[model samples]
Target: MVTTQRLPASLTPLDAALAAVLRDLAPVQPIELPPVDALRCIAAEMPALRAYPPHDVAVGDGWAMRANDLVGASSYAPLPLAGLPVWVEAGAAMPDGTDCVVDADAVDASGPLPQVLAEAVPGQGVRRAGSDIAAGRTVIAAGEPLLPRGLLLARAAGLDLVRVRRPRLRIVNISKGGLAVQLIADTARLAGAEVVRLKAGPDIVTIANSLDTGGCDLIITIGGTGVGHTDAAVNALARRGALIAHGIALQPGRTTAIGRIYTTPVIALPGAPDQAFAAWWAIALPVLDRLSGRRPRTTLALPLERKIASGVGIAEVVLLTRKQDHWAVLAIGDLSLDAIARAEALLIVPGGAEGFAAGTLVDAYMLRE
Candidate 1:
C-alpha cells in the first residue's frame, strides 16, 4: 500500500480549492444531445447551427412605409397617399412597399380610412430581421453557463439542436442509510447527477482497494476524512493516485481533502453531519461545475442576524437563515446538523472574516432548490 502526505493547514477559499482540483483534469467530451431545448444545461461552445435574425423583423404595431410619404403631412393636413397603406399590427409582415411603420396612433380615421399625420423615417419602428441577433454568429459562446434566458434566445435564433457538455458526478461514501445519506442522495438528485456510495472500513488499504474497480467520474468519501488515525480516505486516494489539496484553511470542514485517483477527481470530507454537508456544498459542488465546463455561481443570500466570531487566517462559511427580518443562526459548530438542515443559505464569511456585528451583510446559499 502507498502512503501520501497532506498539504499545509492554510485554508483556501472554495473556488481556489476547486480550481486546484480541476487543474490538469481533462474536460469531458462534448455531446450532441438534441434540438436546442432544455433549460438547465449549457450549450456547446460552437453550436451546431447558425443564429438569426437573418434579416430585420417588425418591432411595433404600425404600417410600414417610406419616410418621404409623410414628409409634410400633419394632424390637420394628413397625407393621403395615392396607394393604400397596408394595415399591419405588431409583429406582422411588413407590406412589400412599406419601409417604415406609421403607428396606428399616429394616424386618424376621420375621412375615408386611416390617415397618418406625418410620414415616418426609414427604419423607424421596424425590427430588422437580424437586428436582435445575426445569423452565422456565435449565439452562445463556449464556457458560458447557459441560463434560461439564453436558452430562449438560442431557440429563437433558429437552432434545431445543440452540443452540450454532460457534467456527471460520482459519489462514494460509507453511510448508505440515515438522514445524512438521504440528504446526500437528495442533493445529488437535485443537482441532476448520479451518486454511488460504498461501505468500506476506515483502513486506507480497504478504501483504496474498494475504489480500484473504478466506474465513476468523480469520487467523494463521506466518512473518515478527518485527522483521526482511522480517517484514511485521503491516504487511500493518494495511494491510488496523487494528492491535489488537503485541509483547506477554514472551519468546521477544514479537514476536507481533494485529490485525483487514476485521473478521476476525489474529495474527502469530515465524518460529522454538518461539516460533511458544508464540505460538499463549499468544495465538491464548484469542482463539479468546473469539470462540466461551467463557471459555478450561486444566488441564495441571507443577511446576518447576529455577530459570529471567526478565525483571522481562514475563510468561514457560516450557515444563516431569515428569522423575522433578522438573520438567526442555528449554531456555529461544524457538527451542528440542525442548523445545516434548516439553513436558507450559507453565510460566506471569507478568509480573515472576524466576528461580524449584529447587522452585518452576510451572504448565504439557499438550501432548498
Candidate 2:
C-alpha cells in the first residue's frame, strides 16, 4: 500500500522556510457557540446586547440620596438624624431622586433615621448606569481570546451567546500506539480547534486517501515520517498531493513533514512524545494561530547563565530554567515533557547562528502551548 524513501538528515529545509509556507494560509468560517462553550476560542466580533449596570445603582451599604442634601453635613456638627434615609444595599437600584450614596460606615444606620458624619460627594459610593461598560460598546474585539473574564463580560452585557472562529481539525496517528494522537489532540484543543479523530487501519493507502478527502481545515498525523522501512507518510502524501516540506532542521523533530491536498493543510509529526510536542508548537501551533486569526505567542529575550552548544547550519531548540532575574540554559537538545514541565521557556538557536554563550542574550519562546 505504501513504499519507503529516505533522504540524508542534512537535506531538510530551514525552519523559516517552513514557517513562511504555513503563514500564507487564511482563517475559516466562524461558528456560533454559547459563552460557556467559547472559552479560549477566537472571537469573531462581540457587539454587546445591553450596558452593564443598565441603571444607576448603589455600590455600598447605606442610604441613597441627593448629594446636595448633605452640603453642610460635617463630623464636628454632624447632620441630625432625619425621619429616615432611603436605605439601599450594594447592587440595589438607586432611587429616582438620588444622585449619590452615603456609605454605611460614614453614617449611623443603627437608629430608625440615619445621621451623616461627612459630606457626600456626587458620585461617591454609587455605580452610575453603564459606568464600567458603556451601552453598544464592543466587548470582544476581533481575534481576541474568549477567556473566562471575557465570558463574564459577555454575561454582564446580557449576551448569552458569542461567535468564535473555530476550524474543524482531524487527527490520525499512523502508528498503532495512540499517545501521539492524544498529545496532538490536546494541543489542537488548546488552540480552540474542533478536533475530529479518524481511526485508520494498517493500510497506508486507505489512511492517505481518507486524510486527503476530509473537509477539515487541517489534518494531523503522527509517526511514519522517519527513515525506517515502515516510515511511509511521505509516500502516502505523495500519492495524493505535494509534500511542501519533508523535514525541518530543528532537533528531535527533524523528520516533521508538511503537505497540502488542495486547500487543507496536512502535518506529519514524529512518534516520540518530546519530538511531537516540540513540532506541535514550532510548526502546527503557528499554523493554527494563523487560521484562527490569533496572534502568535510572544518571544522574550533572556540572558543565559551557561553556554548552550548547537550546530550552525541546523536549527537548535533549547529549554531554559528560571533563575533570579535571568534564565539558565538547559539544552538537553530537545526537552521531554517532564523536563519542560520544570523549565520556564523554550529557547531557539536559529539556523543563522551557532549557539549562545554563558551570560549572553538568547531569544526564547514563552511556554504558551
- lDDT (10s digit) by residue, model 1, range 60-89: 777667787778888878777555566677
- Candidate 2 residue spans exceeding 4 A from truth: 8-10, 16-20, 48-50, 74-83, 103-118, 135-137
lDDT of 2 by residue, 68-111 (tens): 88888887867766656788988999999888887666687676
Q: For model 1, where is the 10-residue window of minimal lDDT?
A: 34-43
True-structure RMSD for candidate 2? 2.9
Q: Candidate 1, TM-score vs. the true structure?
A: 0.65
Clashing residue pairs for model 2: none
TM-scores for all predictions: 0.65, 0.88
Candidate 1 global CA lDDT score: 0.67
Superposed Cα deviation of residue 243, candidate 2 (Å)? 1.7
